[model samples]
Target: MAVTGISANRLELLSIADAVAREKNIDREIVIDAIEEAIQKGAKSRYGAHHDIRAKIDHKTGELSLTRHTTIVADDWEPEDELEEFNDSAMVRLRDALKRDPEAEIGKEYIEVLPPFEFGRVQTQMARQVVTGKVREAERANQYEEFKDRVGEIVNGTVKRVEYGNTIVDLGRGEGIMRRDQSIPREVFNVGDRVRTYIYDVRPEAKGPQVMLSRAHPGFMAKLFSQEVPEVYDGVIEIRAAARDAGSRAKMAVLSNDSSIDPVGACVGMRGSRVQAVVAELQGEKIDIIPWVDDEPTFIVNALAPAEVSKVVLDEDADRVEVVVPDDQLSLAIGRRGQNVRLASQLTGWQIDIITEAQDSERRQKEFAERTGLFQEALDVDETIAQLLVTEGFATVEDLAYVEAYEVAEIEGFDEDTAEELQTRAREFLERQATELDNKRKALGVEDGVLEIEGVTPQMAVALGEGGVKTIEDLADLATDEIRGGHEIRGGERVKLAGVLESFNLSQEAAELLILRARVAAGWIDASELPQPEPEPEPEFEDVEGEDAFAREYDDAEGEVEAVEPEGDTDEPQDA
Candidate 1:
């Protein structure tokens, strides 16, 4: 067949499709599909547009065919189903179709061969454009599918162009975009520079697939190490966690599967060759390779290596840790602008606070003295008794009041009578303190609604009122964190909303419950409207006999229908 000024050759068409597919790095089938679609469009222009025209290509020979398709239907058929639309060009009566095929049936398609058209210059140009557009679209879809699963993988590409601080990388088969923020700090790139980046995201858009590349991502450093270290790549040395300060510094926690292999030594290589390679790729980003430990305190000590830890105190409830180091190591442990502790926190998933041994010792002495003084004043006990109580882990008057008589008596140099007296004094002191706080709450104009919440004591209510949260609605408006920690204002000034609640020492769960109660009281939520679990579905009767028996048994069961009916429906079914 010949187009107006164009000739169709099966071998030449196949060659062109193979070349295009190779150049686009797409499947040859996609190129053939594009060609078929382009030919179908051209056929529609040459023939009637209203005809149900279709086109296909012979995969092996690349021979193209254009045809008109008509659906065979009953002679008296009326379009009822959504698929059976009335169209003269799409359907043929059964009788008419049977003339061509005596065994023709309704819903079977009839294909009529059409003569291939000769294409004009304008038509050829249009077909070429259509094929090119389809190929480009297919290329994008292929790119998306290829890179979507590769997210979090490290990719190597050459810098193609830099536009407004955004680097466009030629990934050989596709392009990737590295936004300025995703690049390492102060890192510079030029055209044709070899770049290694993490494929952080692949977004499919109308224009094309957006392949997001990043160098500052922690995963990039992990991948770099994986590439440099055989043990890491082989999963013998597993990177437990990584935290990066971009081009400045990074910390990684690694664990070894084989007890014989040292994770840190494997990552560092001989004379730091392995780690140095990763650092060079990151533009000299200093990386600290620490061995991962299951014990958090020991792990933190490892993370803060080179700084000898004098003591480590963990506040498990708050997920925070305090590291006390030697006076000389304090600066090193904290790092410049607290980077060391910050990275350690990130790696360990805990909040870390560092202090000198001297400072920690001073704080401890102060706390002991304060507890001794509190017991002395509240329990009317002497220094010795107060010291004993403090040493026994009684930090507050409330602790002494709430302890069992036997527990108090178990302390050294204390009997049952002494325990009872101490308990009485503790309770009396607390009652007096509560009375004073209640008077203050009233004086502060704290509403009764605010005082009624479970976690809000009289002192907390007064604090809330002082902080401008005088109503139940005000307390309800506060977030759980706000009630627990309050917020810091400008110039480091903290607005203490629930700071007074610290005396009560409520747990996070208690504080949240208190906030929920306040919300309920403020009519923000219904207390009884908690989410209920969905009931399990009834078992299906698998056998036909069982199913039929169930149906009959259910039908004979009296009041079964009435029991399942909606409440308050009085209408009954008439006798059928």
Candidate 2:
């Protein structure tokens, strides 16, 4: 039967298609595809046809209709693999194309068209379900496409629902997923609560494009600053650098090209309104907006917030810094868990060693006295003599100890024995110092360095540079192919970069420490990078424990005082 009562349904479909297009922000074709797909599924259920069918609408007439397509074939042609074969002259070009593929024949009937029947109880119910589900899905996909490119952008969304610590944000376009990891710690949300988030990631997957929104991203800070300070948006105040421990604290360094505007004051706002708004959004996450300075000392001072720095000594060649603080503020400068100076070190891009005023003063005084010799009371002759001997060409204790008596007689006023005495004293000092240095190395937990070898490539060097595989975790992370080349130690010739070992040229022990430190830094292993120590040589079975007097070994044949063995019925060794 030809269906005629579809004009109202056609109008309804058009209305739905338009409304859904507006809802999902997509064009009308997507909705039409969804509708056609739903109709096909409905037709399958309605007719119980041999194969699936399709439906379409008259584009010009605005009339709803259906069409079914199936393979036309004659009764004689054979399709080798199938139980049915419809290859004959009556069939169209099916047999002609099939000659290229013997598995299919021209006359094979793939499907047969069927007339449209009135949609009844079961078909109408099924058609409505399929249409509704597909339309909603298409809408979600449209929303995904609409928002995917806007990753890293800021948007306000209302909390629509929460499940498993994930908040579904209704952005009016669609629901954006704010996962547990994306949320600021301790911040809570309820239905209809509007919150701002940074669109961080958008993953197009099977169900839909997953919209990943975050409140803890670094861009969130930038966005908030942009919102608060007009200068940032207008390009007057430049945010030179920003570092964040999300949910805890954030430190940002800003520079002002416009001298008329104070960057810090602008960001802080009058009476602290601007920064306060950000703080409220972060649930009281502290923010420090500091003025960036070019001079390292000045920069370091600003980097260490809430604590005053007295001095900063930068060692560019060594990439290290010494931060001097007043004795009273030493503890405060380091902060709880060393957070203050640690963050300052990161911001300043140097390895920072903090020294209090007392330590710095003592060091300066000692160096001054050594250089001037103005004060003799505090100057030990041993240190002075050590310096003198070093300057006089007796460089090391080993060299001094091996010097002949004849050579010791060369220096004026110093006889052979006196020189010998000097050598003895120098030797003793070096020995004690060597022992102390060993203890220090042990205390520091020395590590290994990289080695240079043939066939080393840049890729291998980068791999070693990034990870020092002293531990099992590092090894576990490597792919099978990477492990094939074997691993390099941090201080080895090929692996350790050139400049890192320069400081150790005058002091080779320093190089050892550097390699070990690099290994530790790479997390290749704990301080002890080696595997468990090899089992100590098993101690020989000694006669000390439970030693039977008669069983004690002795030179009996030589007539020495030796215990004689009673060999008869005692627990005698098995006969070999």
What's the distance in Å from true for residue 380, model 1? 4.2
Which lDDT tens digits does candidate 1 get at residues 1-576? Answer: 135322356777788889999988888988888877777777877776678898888999767777899898789988788786667887889988878888899999978988767776656777898889989999999989989999989989999999999999999779999999999878899999998889999999999999999999999999988899999999999999999888888889888999999787888888888888888888988888777766565677778765666556666656777777889998888888888888888899988888897897899799999999999999887999999998887878888898889999999899999999999999999999999888888888788878887667777888787777889998888776666666657677766554535555566866777777888998989987533447999986554231101111121211111111112322111100
What is the TM-score (0 to 1) of candidate 2? Answer: 0.55
Per-model TM-score, in order, reads 0.73, 0.55
lDDT of each: 0.80, 0.63
lDDT per residue as tens, model 2, 1-576: 113355646766777778777765677776777776666666777665545466776544446666555454543545778675442322445555466556665435444545555666766676677767777677667777788889878999999999999999988777789999889988889998988989988887778778889998867887888888999989899887766666877778888998899888888888888888888888887877887766455566667767666566655545666777789888878877777677667666867788898999999767554533411221234455445544445533556666786676676556877777766665676667666654543343332222222222223333344444433234334443243322446666545333312222312333334344444555755767633446889767645322212332233222222223233332111100
Q: Name the best candidate (by TM-score).
A: 1
Judging by lDDT against the true structure, name the best candidate: 1
Each prediction's RMSD over C-alphas, in Å, is 17.7, 23.0
